[model samples]
Target: MPDECVILADGPAALVELCGISTLERLLRTLQRCGITRAIILSSSAAEIARRLARPSWARADLEFTIHERPPGPTTVQQIVDLWPEAAARLLLIQGDVVFDIRLLRTLLAQTSSAMLIDSSAPETNRGKLCGAALLQREWAVARNGSVESALLEGLEQHTAEALDVANQPLYDPGLRRNLRPICFPAPALANKQAAERVLFDSVQKGTLDFPAWIHAPIEKFLLRYLCRTSITPNQLTISWAIAACLTTIFFATGHLIWGIVLALVVGILDGLDGKQARLKVETTAGGKIEHHLDSFFDVVWPIALAFHFYSSGRLPTAFYYLVVLLAGEGVDGIAKAIIYSGAGRLMTRSICATHRRPAKYLHLGVGHRADSWSAGKGSNCDGVVGIDDCCNRHSASSTDVDLAPKNTLVDQLTINPVGLVLGCADRFDEAVYHNVVFERHAELALEAAAYALFHYLQNKRLGNAGAAILSQNAERNETHCANFATIVEQLD
Candidate 1:
């Protein structure tokens, strides 16, 4: 059996952009995450793609990418057989346009013979879609000459084969008959500007912990669509927002409360953009780290600035109390994060041990500690959303593994405090945390602005009544939103 996986990247689907990244890049990253170090990409624009992948961000030192000019008038299977006969028996075939769970690929790779994944729960029109992925034996691929769907069907008729039903698995195939659906795609149609905007809005993380940012998601999506088209980097967006946040600090310090509040909201929107842009453009680890550090600095400064504003307004008692609460709340949140990380480390250790013991079954799963250097040491912080390695790490412990056997110390620890596990290691947890931390802080800032206005009004009605009324109204809305966010977080826990 040949060791190389074959990716078909010649179709229109490969050009489609989902959540800011090209479908082809997503496919390549997925393969790398599965420990596939060699891949043969069949693309019509092979030269262009090869140039793009030469960049450090897309190129992997461990992975050797071979681009074959896709031949016209021949289907993917036939083209592969004609060009790469040596890989006939051992090819993992994947369509460039679709986004599928890594778990499905792991399952397919474990199969010894030709097999195809079918979504049993897909709409009737999509019944034979094959999800645009298959495990092809060299003999089978060479013997057929049609669409992958037709070839798979013919192979099934000719020989005994495995047709794994992955209807329950997450899949995002734009070629399917049905319209967009589910959290799997994370987007809608990516056909045009209007459609892309809808895709961005739809792609916003919608998990329980994401409730805090749900309100601003639409506006963020609007900004994201435009940002995606520009050469503006994620670091640029982060720096721009940081400047705005600094201006906001000046406004509050100078008693220009309304302007401060408005600028703060702008900062919030821009804050949301940086990460969205990063994920969309497939930015480097250094870019993300820069954004996080800048964000952390401002996260501390904003509250301190607000406390100063309150102090200067002759509300010493209120200012001190607010400062204490804000500081304490942040401290507690930090501790919670630390605990979650510690728990995740424990879970990962156990999972790695189990993986080593049953190497074959877990081969396509976690890459263990060695994965840390695969993508510039970003694997250690595998947020599970952006990087492919992280995504695999998130799902490394399969459902069967979770269900089996001995209730060890690690299992007992997880059972006793599932909050850490869910918050730290779940597939969507990092996304939830990314959006929630920014918007949640914005929510708290809104409340602080409202409190400042109310206190100012009480100190001098003539000077503050109008601002107080507006701020109070906005605060009420934000407070209600915060309450809803709290409820969702509680439910997640």
Candidate 2:
């Protein structure tokens, strides 16, 4: 991948704001995240953009951000190259008007020395017209009159095979993603956008939302509409919700069920906003761990408060017994989850993050089959979802997912090379290339080996569902999403 980029900052769309930030700023952040070391901005309105754009303070300290208030002409190109000879090696040139998915950049970076982004879904008239981005080398000569748009069109030669291809594909189809879906990003660049605002909200949405959160989505969106316009930050929302949680406990302890229920529902909905606002505005913090403990504390406290209310109001004769049962169940569940997370730590985290952090609505043992059923991985999401290595393919791919076991089939093939385990060690910073080891003949040993491999990795990611996030950004590093587990209140409702 190219380490540097040249963004042509121009046009009204370049200044378009989404989630309280402009497109230029968003692109810069994305670039920094994707490992861009140096960036040169060519814009007539460079000074104006600097005034309006709020660049991220957390961006790489070593990243060079240079702005030139001119078009991409021979003089300008020569000036950039003379100052930085590394530009001769390779660099990506992007138009400021085009807000794109990072995957497109990744795809372009994977190409040989030079390539341009191709939007197969683009209209016929705009086919040769710039998709507004290209990976370039010093081999291409810049004319005296050249603009950023003309840089990609330097030669009449059209090369599409090695470059990025945005095939016209169904957004939900994971099979088509093998082509890398250059244009068909899980969160498509800014496709189908009236304003990037709606897309920003849509991008943060998960596949399986529990009932309360399902109910809360639109209400919070309405609230977010105003929140995005303000100076209020994510930590502020977190603090507000924490304060509201205390108020909820007070109402419940006072034996006011109606007020408690209303307030609790309000708090549950607002609980989602802080993270949403944080992501949309790119303001996530490490102090979020404090928020996690507070949430867990409230989760335990709220139920106790409700039980106390039931007893005080004489709403139930067996309220004390019910409270005991609730505490016992919570204790058992928490311990089991902790064990699972600790034991299957790396395997589960890598698998889940690879599948785009969408919590599973369905949990299956094997790739495509349900826990109650059995079938070879076909006519389902087996092929595209599981990263089956040579070991599994040589014998059987019966057990590829975490947290599940087959009832009928247990094909044990242990006399194979540990390619998956080896691949898992290759990139310590990335999601594991492989994560499963199933032994029907010896389930305990399988679990132990898997546990040991996973435990050593110990990434902070939590375990999630199998093949659940196939249609989303599988293996998107550093994506922080709150798990919306079903609560007793939501379940009852």
Candidate 3:
């Protein structure tokens, strides 16, 4: 592989219902126009649905347009890495639902430096509403991990002033991502009004969209003016969006039906402005990553709270439906974001950040499969996703597992969700704080919550089919590594 960029297609459902044939065709056209050849697509069980219903010519070539079926329940995102560690490295990862202009994607990649595709039209109310997209350079593929989503989450959790204590101490800390170029790609609304209208129309025609057609059209005059206000930084606006989303959750939980819909609309619009702010000001920094983290947090927590509220109000059935939509949307996008970031993080951390430093020895066990030929620098820990020191020749069958497991107690304690255990520590933060007391507190609480969720689901038998259930179990198991992240941070405190 000549260091290809990966494009992640989240799942089958988003592919068919969200993008439809026309939108998907448009995206393909854009990709072709932009000169991007190799990419990856993350598919779900519904992938078969899209293939059966709206079959496309590109999909016929399974080798080129690879669709990694999302695993059951929580396992959806991790499955991409668990299954295809090789392709995970070189990909222009993208989700199914998010529709971006091919021109913008090209513009994003042209930066040569680190760049993110920010939705300039993302409204303040909707700024952190969804996962923002980014364009990764070839060098980023160096720090590859099975789950790019986990990598960023790890970054966010470790984003404090004291995170630098582990540097040069047998620890790898890609100093909190500070300055990456953010290419402000105007949203469909601002870039192409007609395309934006068509997207909304398509959603309505499919009946998959709950909001009205006007929501996707050009921004309202007042909203535009509000965004132009001088005092707001994009991060503050994003946090405000989080607060609004939190409010929406509270309203939904309280049985405020009409208000919930209105709030959802508000959230959607608010999310439109984030990219705009970044573009207008040309502001990209470590602080921006913090905003991105806030956006992801609200995406997860808000809908979850709403679902719980509806369930508590005796509309368990309806709540389940909403819950599924929320989870599916977030889960699929989360996976895509992970795939995209993994490629980006690799270049930034390895070649850009670590290029000047001499390779040092670090001890850690290997979980998933290791690359037979490809490997990272000496004593470097290559997580299943990226950071390879050697090349993997797919033709060879050197499948024997390696066991240079670390003797560190904390290393042993690290468990992965949807998989079993996360073996390698990406940064020294894992050693210094992840195993400390503050982290212990968050870990205990998160574990309790995970246990409770498992018990509830099992009792209700919400695992759906056997495959889904098995995958769900695997995902939950793997998530223990990610879920305990907060606790790890508390340890630093």
Which candidate should be chosen as best, given lDDT against the real structure?
A: 2
Compute each candidate's TM-score over C-alphas: 0.54, 0.57, 0.28
lDDT tens digits by residue: candidate 3, 238-283? 7777778888878877878689779878876666555445433323
Question: Which digits, one per residue and each the tens of the lDDT, describe model 1 over residues 1-493?
Answer: 2376887776566756665556677667656655688888888877767776666544244567778886555464566676665724578887776665554565466454577766656533334435667776666666677676667766655544456556433232211211223322322344454555455455433332355366667787777777777778777888898899899988877778899999988887887777767654545344466766777787778777878887888866488687788888988998998776545423332342212122222111111132122223122321111100111223244321111111111221111111111000111121221111111112212222222222222222222111110100112234311111110111110
lDDT of 2: 0.51
Better of 1 and 3 by lDDT: 1
TM-score of candidate 1 relative to the true fold: 0.54
Q: Quote the lDDT for 288 in model 3.
A: 59
lDDT value for model 3: 0.38
lDDT of each model, Cα atoms only?
A: 0.50, 0.51, 0.38
Using lDDT as the measure, name the better of candidate 2 and candidate 3.
2
Tens digit per residue, CA lDDT, model 2, 1-493: 4656788776556777766666777677667656687888777777876766535455334456887776433334554354345536667777666666654554455444466766655533344334766776555533323443444454324432223345421122111111123332221245545445676676554443367766888888888888977888888888889888899999888887788888888788778888777666655555765877888899889888888878878887678798889889988989997877445523542343232232222222233322222244323332121222111222322223333222222333111111111011111112222222222222112333433333222221223223221111112242211111110101110
Ranking by TM-score: 2, 1, 3
